[model samples]
Every structure is written in structure tokens, then in C-alpha cells.
Target: MNLDTGSSDIWVPSVNCETPPLCKSINKYNATASSTHKQAAGSPTFNLGYAVGGLTGLRATEVVSLGGLTINDQIIGEALSEPTDSYNYPFDGTFGFGWSIISATDQNSTPLDNLYEQKQISKRLFCIKFTDQTQATQDAIPPGGELSIGGCDVEADYWRPLSVDGFWQIKMTKLEVGPATDGGNKLTLCENGCEALFDTGMGPIGGPPDEIELITKQIGAHFDKQSNYYIITPCDIASLPNVDFQFGEVTVTLTPKDYMLTVSPQICYTGFSKMNTKYQKADYLLGDPFLRKLTVIYDKDNKRLGFANLK
Candidate 1:
């Protein structure tokens, strides 16, 4: 399952589902096969739409186990219909770490909530450390990093209060280009404070079209019509300026190497993309590029997020 912090519902294809050819190839949930599974009263319809695809299912409760921590009576969706085009990936389903308020499953307590309430975890929080793909490949280390439950690392550099309850949304003060010493080239963005979502489900950094165009222009990024993405061919990685994201007093910086995904020796793709039309809930979606540089802590108990520079 994909650990998605962007959405607030757990959904897996059900054995009864026949449509979406891919669903039949992937793992499906069978309520009868699980001893802890319980169908919800009335079996309310569960419908969750995403940027790419959507799913329609029925609400159910089951014992969810994550890294040995068992969450009993966790609300889940038994998908009866799925999008084959969107679910072609290897993963069977998505395990949402988002808050319950955004959940489509009748606003029932989320799996994380159940973990805390059932004493499976001492604290209402979780931490994620994403490994840089570039570095991991060179160092021969694991690709994906660790997802620690219950508590956060003591070495966090900053903590910001969540702007809303739905997504892991926070306030961003400004976004700047260039180094800190030269005062940087501050973009006319987030001047009035912008809401940003730290989304694990997203791949690239997402923002408004105009703002992203401005950012790409500043970085000398050329849009590739074929790939529908921006690329910096013959990328002079060392010459690129640092991009800074200011959250009040705390400023997180992403170096050129951190934001560029190298496809080949001569080509590198900038990790900047426009937000999909379906999900315009935030000013920016800080995805894997931003995440690879810091350890993110989702503290639901205090309704805040913590960021620490990765070592």
C-alpha cells in the first residue's frame, strides 16, 4: 500500500469488484477471509475522488496492522469500482495518514486515530524520513525511508501549526530564489501568506500555474511538450540557485541537486509542476523533492507539523 498523507481515506479493491481489469490482477480485500473484518451498518457508500482517478466502495471496519502496530476497528473502504488507468502501479491500495475531518468514510475516526485510541501508539503522531533517490542509488541504500509512529525525532529544526484540519496544511510566508546572503530573488508569492500541503501522494512540487511558470523561468527550465513537464537539458546542477521556502522564522532551502530529477547524463527534470484542477485546496503541494530534504512529523495531537533537516 502507498502511504499517502494527502488524502484521508483507506481504500482497497474488493474481491467482489469485476470492473477495472487491473483490480483483478492486484490484491483484493475479502471480508469473509478476515476474522476481524466487520461490515459497517447499512454498508454506506464510500466515494473518494483524486487528481488522477477515483474509487467507489462500501464502508467497513477491520483490524489494520502497520509495522506490527495493530489498529482495531479501523474504518476502511471496500472498493467495488476503481480506475484502471490510474491504478496501474504495483501498489494494491493507499493507506491515508490524513486527519479524519477530510475522510469520505462518513467522517469516521481514521486509522491513525484508532491507533492512538486503541493504545497501539502512545502518541497521536507519526514521522516520515524519505531517502533521496539519487543518493540512495549511489550509496546502495534502500529507496524509501522509514515511517516512525507515535513520536518525532528530537532534532527537528522547526514546528508550524496546521492551517486546517483536512490536509496537513501549513502557512508559508514566502518563496525565494537564490542564496540567503544575496537577499535572494523573492517571488511575488505567499506575500499574504499561502496555505501549503505536505503531500506524500504527489511526486513533484505543485503550485498555481503562473507562479510555477515564473519559478521555472527563473531556473532556466524548458517545458517539454512531449513529456508535459519541464526539463533542464545539459543541466549545470552546480550553477543552479537555491530555492527557499519561508515559514515565518523557519526557512527551508532546497539546493539544485535536491529539486532536480536526473533522467540521464544530459537531461534533468525540474521538480515543479502545476496543481491538478480537481485539487485546488492549497497554494502549494510540497511533494517528494521537498520531502527528501527534511524529516516530516505529523503531530495530530497538537495539530502541528515538524520539519528537521535530514542528516
Candidate 2:
């Protein structure tokens, strides 16, 4: 299963008549085979909506193991119906890390919250170190990708307070292009500021349609109507200006190398996309393209997010 910081329920496919063939292709959780399995009363259905698709399932409780640690009576959803696009991923399901406020199950606490309550970990914190796409493209197994629960290794350079306690969201103060030192040439994109969600499940950085289109145009990219993305010639990548995201007092910069998604030797795509309306709470979603540049720390206890350069 993939670790999803945007949601709040642990889900896996179930072996049932409603289960799709794609779910079977991955792995299925057999509730009947587990001695610790406890069906929720009323067999209430669980419906989870995502940025693109959704999942429908039944709720259940069972023991879940993570390395040597074991969590008993962990609340989980047994997916009976999933979107076809969900099957394209390597993960069978998602292990949500968001707060219970965003949970589909209407539970009082999440698995991570339960672990903290059980005194399994000293700190209610998790760290994510994403692999650089450029490095990953060259090597089969990039060395730096990590998901550390309870604590992190590096000291944070800046800590951004969460605007909402639900989805690891932060208040973005500004968005601009070019270096901060280059005051005359800097182009302000989102001067009014907006809320941004830190989503590990998303691959590209996303914003409002108007803002994304403006950024693409400024970066010498053309809209590919068929692909529904902004494509640029590989030659323009080197000359493109850096984009900067300001979170309160801290500003993180992403150069063309960080925000350009290489499609082929001659073609590349901008990392920005139109914000999916399904995620209505935030105007922006910062994904791997931005995350790969920093060591992100999700501090549940403090209700804040910390960022530092990768070690």
C-alpha cells in the first residue's frame, strides 16, 4: 500500500463479487481468513473520493503489521469497488496519514492516532524524503526515498504553520517567478496568496486553471489539447526562470530542472497542472516536483509542517 497523507483511512481490496478484476490482480484481504478480523456492526459501507476517482468498500477491523510492530484492531476498509485508473499504480491500496477529521469512516481516530494513543511512538511526527525524478530515471532504485514514522533525521530550516488541521495544509503567502534578488524581473503569479495542500500521493504540482495557464505561457510552453498538459521544447528548459513559493517568511525556490517533467529527448512538460476540483479546500497541491527538493516533516502534535534541504 502507498502512504497517502491526503486521506485518513487505511484501505485494501476485498475478495467479493463486487470486486473488480484489477483489484484481484493486485492483492486482496480475506477477512474470513483472519482470526483477528472483526466486522463492523451494520456492515456500513465506506465511500472515499479522490482528486480524480473514488473507492467504495465495507469497513472492518483487523490486526496490521508494520515491520516488527503490530497494531491490533486497526480500522480498515475492504474495497469492493475502485476506479479503473487506480489500478495503474504499483500499490494495492493506500494507508492514510491525515487526521481523523478527513476520514471517510467517521472514526474518532486514525491508525497513526491510535498508534500514538497506544504509546507505540514517542512523537506524533512523520518525515518524507522523496526520490528525485531525474535520479530515479537513471537508476532502478534511487537511494534517498524514505518514510520515517515517529521522527526525522535532519533539522528543519523552516516550519510553516498549518492553516487547517485536516490535510496538512499551509497558508501560501505568495507565488512568484525569477530569483528573489531579481526584484525588477520577478513575475508575481499569485500575489493574493492561497491555501496549499502537501500531498504525497500526487506526482505534479497543481494550481488553479488560470494560474497554471499563465505560468505555462510565461515559461514558453504550449497547451497540448489532446494530452491536457503544457508541453515545452527541451531547449527552453535551460533558459526558463525559477518559480518561488512563499510560505509566511520562508520561500522555497524550484528551478526549471526541478519543475520540468521530461517526456522525451525533445519534449518536456511543466510540472504544474490545473487543480482538481475534488480537492476544494486548497487552491494548490504541492506534489513530488516540489517535495523532492526538501525533507518534509508532518508534525501532527504541533499542527505544522517543517521543511529542510535533503541531506
Candidate 3:
């Protein structure tokens, strides 16, 4: 399952008339079969909105286990209907790590929050390290990443204070593009500061359409209407400039190798895309592409975010 810091509620597809056939291909949580399962009072319905679309489902509680840890009567959503495109991913479901403030139900405590409340963990914190794919060869397995609950490594290189109290948001000071070398000619993409959300659940780095279009154009990429992506020649990947994001005192530089996605032998796509307007509170949504390079710590106690080079 994908750890989603952008949303609330743990959900999996269930056997129902509206359930997609693809749900059978992956793991399903049969609420009816679990002895500890109990329907939520009033059988309240829920609709979870996402970048792709939305998922409609019923709420319930059941025993949930992770590794050797177990939580009884954990709240979960049994998805009855979802977007057809949602099944394309390899994961079975999402384990929401966002704050209880973002939950759909009145009983807003997330599983993680409950774990802390139940004293299963000592700290209200978690850390994530995403596998960097740039080092992978064609058809070769990439190095796996790690996720740690309760606390994170204290050896992080930088720990920046979060600008906002929710959604792991930080204040972005600027964005620049240039060679990785010091004193290189850097082109400013976004000069004015804006809020950025660091989300482990999303794939690409997203922002306003105009900014995305400008950045793509600077990198010699063209928007492909059919694919809804910006395509560039694979050969040009090495020649493209590094994209730098300034988050207060810390600056993260993403090389072409980190921001380009190989679509085919000769074609690649930019990892930056336009975000949905409705969820535009943050000027940018920094996802896996950005997170993969760093060990990110979500410090709920401090209400801040910390980063260090992934070891």
C-alpha cells in the first residue's frame, strides 16, 4: 500500500455491485469475513477526492496489522466505486498519514493518530525514504526505500520549520534552473515565494499551468495533448539543466536525471505537471520525484518537516 500523507482514511476495494472487476486482481479487505469487523454507526457514505478523480465508499472498522504491530477496531473505508484508471497502480490500497483534520468522517482520528493515542508508538512522527530510480538500468530492479514509524533518524542534514500547520507544507522562496556547477547561469522560474506541499502519495511535482508550461519550454519539452504530458527527446535528458527549489534556508537541486521520465527508448517526459485548480492552496505539490532524493521526516510534535540526503 502507498503511504499517503496528503489524505486521511485507510481504504481498500471491497466486494460490492459497484466494485471494479480489477479489485479482484489485488487484495481485498472482506469486512464481512473479519470477526472484528463492525459497520460504522449510521453507515455514513464518503467520497474521497483525488487528482485523478474520486472514490466513493462506506466506512467501517476492523483489525489492521502492520508488520508485528496490530491495531484493533481501526477505521477504514471499503471502496465500492473508484475511477477506472485507479486500478493501474501496483499497490492494493492507501494508508493515510495525514492529520485527523483532513479526515472525511466526524471521528477524524487516523490510524497513525490512534496508534500514538494507544501508546503503541512513543512518538507522533514518521520518516520516509523513496527509492531513487535515476540509478536504475533498463529492466533492472531499483533499490528499495524505507519507512520508519514513531521517530526518524536524528542525523538529518537539514530540518526546516514548516510554514503551515497542516499537510506538511513549507514556504517555497524561489525556483531556479541551471547547471549543477556553482556560479552557473541560473534562470528564475518562480521568484515570489509560495507554499509547497510535500506529499509521498503523489508521483509528479505539480504547480500552476503557466509555470509548468514555462518550465517545460525552458527544458525543450513540448506538451503532448493526448498523453497530457510534456515530452522531450531522451538524448536531451543529459543536456537539460537542473531544477532548484528553495525552501527557506535549504535548497534542493533536481538534476535532469531526477526530473525526466523515460517513456520509450527515444522519448521521455517531464516529471513536472499542472496541478488541479481546486486544490491550489499550495503553489506546488512536491511528490515522489522530489522526495526520492531525501530522507523526509514528518515531525508532528514539532509541526515541522526535516530533510537529509538519502543514504
Candidate 4:
């Protein structure tokens, strides 16, 4: 299952869905196979639409176990209909680590909430440590990371209070381009500060179209209409400057190695992209590129988030 902190709902395809070729490859949940499965007939239909994909399902309850933490009577979406083309990934389902206020079920049905309420976890917090593969070579292992539930890693050096109740949103005081020592140009786009979401579900760094266009222009990144990404020549990677995201007094920096996704030896794509306006409420989305540079801790107890350099 994919762990998404930006969303607040759990969904897995059901065996009853006979969407042929699509369902054939996906692992379906069998109610009869699980002794703890319970039907939620009176519950409303489960429907959730994301930036690219969506799912329509029925409500149900089951026992969920994660990293040895067991949660009973957890509400889940038994998917009846889903777009195979959009969800054709390695994961079979999605587990939300967000607060209940954003839950599609209109109830406090998130696994994180249940675990805390049931006393299964001592703390209402979790931490994520993404492997720093920014400077990886050809022989380097593919992207991988660790998610710590119930507790946070003591390695976090700084903590920032969340600005909103739903997503793990924070205020970005400034965005600077070039080297910090050289006094990089402080972009005026966020002069008054901007709302940014620390989204784990997103892969690249996303921002408003105007802001992204400016950043790409500053870095000499050209937008590729075909691939819908800002392309940068491999040779230019070495000459690229650092991009820094300032959250209050904390400044998270990303070098060219961190912001450029190397597709191959000859081609590379900028990790910064234009945010999808359909689902974008925040001015910026600090995705994997930002998270990989700094370990993040989601503190639900105090409604704040923490960050630190990896140990």
C-alpha cells in the first residue's frame, strides 16, 4: 500500500470488482478471507478523486495492521470501480496518514486517528526518512525510504508549527535562487509568504504557474510540452545553483543534484513543476525532492511538523 500524508482515506480494490485486465493484476481484498471483515451497509458510498486518479467504492470495516501496530474496526473503502490506467502502479492500495478533518468518509476514520484513539500508539506522530539518492550514480539503488509510525525520530533538529488543520501546510517566508553565501536573489513572488504543503504523495516540487515559470527561467530550464516537464541539459547540471525554501527561521536548501531528476546519462528533468490548479490550494507543494533533502516528522499531538538533516 502507498502511504499518503496528503489524503485522509483508506482504499483497496475488492474481489467483487471484475474490471478484467486491470483487476486481474491488482490484489483484491476478499471479505471472506479476512475473519475481522465487517460490512458497513448503512454508510454512504466512498468516492475520492485525486489530481490524476479516482476511486468509487463501498464502506467497510476491517482490522488493519501496520509495522506491528494493529488497529481494529478501521473504516476502509472497498473499491468497486477504479481507473486501471491511472492506478497501474506497484501499490495495491493507499493508506492515509492525514488528520480526520480531511477524511472523505465524513467521520474520524483515518488509521492514524484510530490507532491513537484505541491506545495502540503511544504518540500521535510519525516520521519519514527518505534515502538521499540525489548524488546517486548508475549503480545506485532505486529510490527507497522508511516510514516510522506511532513515534518520531529523535534526529529531527527543527520543528515548525502547522499553518492549517487539514494538510501539513506551512508558511514559506522566502524562496531564493543561487548560492546562499552569494546572497541569492530572493524571489518577490512570496514576499508576503506563501502557503506550502509538505506533500509526500507528490514526486516533484510544485508551485504556481507564474512562480514556476520564473524559477525555470532563472535556471535556464525549458518546458517540454511532450513530457510536461522542465528539461535541463545534463551538462548544465553542474552549473546549476541551489534553490532554498525558507519556512519561518528554517531554510531548506536543494542543490542541483537534489532538484534534478536524471532520466538517463544524456537527459535530466528539473524537479520543479507547475502545480495542478485543479487540486492546488497551497501555493507550493514540497514533494519528494524537498523531503529527501530533509527528514520530516508529522506531529499530530501538537499539530506541528519537524525537520532535520539526516544522520
TM-score of each: 0.88, 0.89, 0.90, 0.88
Better of 2 and 3 by TM-score: 3
1 against 4, candidate with superior TM-score: 1
Candidate 4 error regions (>4 Å): 16-26, 134-142, 179-188, 277-280
What is candidate 2's lDDT per residue for 16-72, written digit by digit as tens?
A: 727464456467788889899988665478888877578888888878876555677
List per-prediction Cα lDDT, in the order shown: 0.81, 0.79, 0.77, 0.78
**Residue pairs in steric clash, candidate 3?**
none
The per-residue C-alpha lDDT of model 3 at residue 241 equals 84
C-alpha lDDT of residue 286 in model 2: 89
| lDDT agreement of model 1 with the native | 0.81
lDDT of 4 by residue, 1-311 (tens): 87788788888878887554337545889888988888865665887876556778788888888888898888888877876455655778888887777787536678888888899988889988787784344548566788888886566678788887777888889888873223455444587888888888777888888889988877768898988789876645777777888877788888888888878877789998886633646788888888887779999888888887643
- Tens digits of per-residue lDDT for model 3 on 1-311? 87888876788877662756436546777777888998877557877877656687888877878756677778888888876665466687788888776776435558787888878888888888877775555547566578888877655677778776557787889998774223445568667788888887787898888888877877778888988888886545767888889876788888888888887878898898887733636788898778887889888888888887743
What residue pairs clash in candidate 2, if any at all?
none
Clashes of each: 0, 0, 0, 0
True-structure RMSD for candidate 2: 3.2
**Model 4 clash number:** 0
The sequence of per-residue lDDT tens digits that candidate 1 reaches over residues 35-129 is 88888775488888766577887899888888999877778898888755566655788898987777888566688888888888899889998
Give residue 91's lDDT in candidate 4 (0 to 100). Answer: 78
Record all residue pairs in model 4 with backbone atoms less than 3 Å apart, i.e. clashing.
none
lDDT of 3 at 205: 90
Off by over 4 Å in 3: 17-25, 136-144, 179-186, 277-280
Task: Give the CA lDDT, 0 to 100, for residue 27 in model 1.
Answer: 83
